[model samples]
Target: MTRTLVVVGHGMTGHRLAERLRALDTSGAWRIVVLAEEAHPAYDRIRLSSYLTGGSRQDLALAGRDFTEDPRVDLRLGCAVVSGDRAERTVRTADGEQLPYDALVLATGSEPFVPPVPGRDLANCFVYRTFDDLDAIRGAARRGRPCVVVGGGLLGLEAAHALRLLGMRPHVVESASHLMPTQLDAGAARVLHRSATGLGLRLHCGTAVASIEAGPDGAVRAVVLGDATVLESDLVVFAAGIRPRDELAAALGLERGERGGVLVDENCRTADEHIWAVGECAAVQGRCYGLVAPGYGMAETVAGRLAGRSPRPFDGTDTSTSLKLLGVHVATFGIIHPRGGPAAEAVFAEGTTRYAKVFLEPESGRLLGGILAGETGSRTALGPFVGHRPPADLEQLLLP
Candidate 1:
């Protein structure tokens, strides 16, 4: 009398779905099967760069050590679902195994976006996505060699740091006018730029890659900028961006987003009631969140519904980010930019030591958004104060 549930893509979000379902489904009404493309089970992709710093594979694992001990759960690593039949309620694997499911959930996550440039497929070039990719980069990296990293966002900075750890000269190339264009404003980026350069890392802002020039051996020799500036390099890494892996859902005629992602409702359900989507692959309310926190929230919502509990709709998520880049603290939360005209802004800076800015309502003194660079001791208290009015004596609390 038990129903079968097939969960596709065993990334962090899919693993979360399985773990939560088994925990809440006490009646054992549904048995779960997890299909993963990678040979390894779920590991934290957010901390992937930590692998370069002596962090082992097991250290990045998200699931428990005894994850597969449960009798109701089946974990199939390196098994990819090739096709799905909605009418038959079945899925076909790459090795010709057919799986029947009363319900199906897609957690395919995403893939890195490599820009179209000549010589991109050269031998010394790579993308920072998986454990294997890091292994390849480390194996190929020569000490004292010059390395070029495209993009200057979170992942790009992490890659540059990793290269520096490997004893390579790292140069970060950003097409945007400033670093972390989507996350930090000009002032915060300037502080980050200074900090990065202080670490012996070079910065090339507002410069787009025109092409990668390969030597006679077909390995990377140098990178040509859009403005015809050529910099010699032995390695190139593209940390441009990521796009959702919604092809499987798209094949089944499921609705998708304008850019790319499997469109889902508030409950993370697709057009077919039995089919659901979560993680970076899912477009909740017509937008896909690339962060693990939001994906974890969606997993909780889906697990509840499958357990016959009250459905909690995934309304939206905050784009808050808090992390250390090259040993420097960086955190940004809630509406870094204002929407309704100009708002009252406060600025605090002391040379290159630290910089902090807070935006408040001109009339009501309500906190709208803020950016903190160089020092973030106040982030622990200030992050929660977003969208609310702070106390009158808030200046003392934010002082470095």
Candidate 2:
């Protein structure tokens, strides 16, 4: 019997899995079927912010515009997998079609977490995640009016900058005291705040909107904060966070995290045999990796195993990351939070801007983790450190 693989999701992870499986397993026995919920093929969701600016929909293309010929891969577009039956090895789609497969992969990626604030349903209110999302924002910007973004993380800042490119000075509100609080250390966050402010983007930190007030006609006019302060707004885009689309998994009786992410083993396999999941939807070792690199790694590992090759198990990935904050560079890695006090040795700190602190076992001096900022040199040095590869002199790596 010929083995068939059905991948549910046309996102980045699903597309990569299809490409890798075909490349890794050259045997002509397996067939690939990819299901896309949207009419368009997979597009680069990472650059959705860029699409907010004046960019064509094709600019965010994840895969080619068309899929045709050769091994005869089947692509079901504009149809969503409503749920699945693991016992029968089948998935029910929105269009009432059942797809049967020997192996199933769930790449059901995340969606923009829309806050529950009032007036979020206004015509001017939106979420920036897909090409359609950007197109909507771009159309709104044609009115040449200011818009407010309700988060200060990477995507939110990028969205705000894209709005500036849309010819509007954007207001960015962060519930946290610092911007990019997860990715950057305090110092780096400060620098990013300065850069964002310098770029003329209004920064509102340590305050959150309690509700969005609207005109009598039911259009957004202002955002009312918890402190009873209200700021006028013509438009609002909420980039607060993302939640995994795991209802399908749960409906199928698959284990999932408290936050609704699919629970997968270190190798990206769920409790059910022959059912694998990856990408932001999978939470392994009690951590959900929202980064692309680890998702790509998980796809490769699963692909490797399907081909009868030895694939390595996945430990949780290091949360270290660096990125441009509205044009300013900021980076952080390792055990940033205060763990074992005085025992954790001070690794590096240069003039309050460049700093590195590590938490060692005190006896072993083994580099457990550390945080880096203000120094671009630390970017390359992070990979080996977080992976616990080898103890390279981080001080030497920092110095000229």
Best by lDDT: 1
Clashes of 1: 0
Q: After superposition, how far is residue 262 of candidate 2 from its true place, in Å?
A: 1.3
RMSD (CA, Å), each prediction: 2.0, 2.8
Per-residue error for 142 in candidate 1, Å, reads 0.5
lDDT of each: 0.87, 0.76
Cα error, residue 214 of model 1, in Å, equals 0.9
lDDT of 1 by residue, 236-347 (tens): 9999888999998756778898878999999999999999999999999788987787898899999999999986787564566787786667776665657668889888
Best by TM-score: 1
TM-score of 1: 0.94
Colliding pairs, model 2? 43-62
Error of 1 at 162 (Å): 0.4
Candidate 2 lDDT, 210-249, residue by residue in tens: 8988887787888887778778888899988888877777
Cα-lDDT of candidate 1: 0.87
How do all models score by TM-score?
0.94, 0.90
Q: How well does candidate 1 score on lDDT at residue 280? A: 96
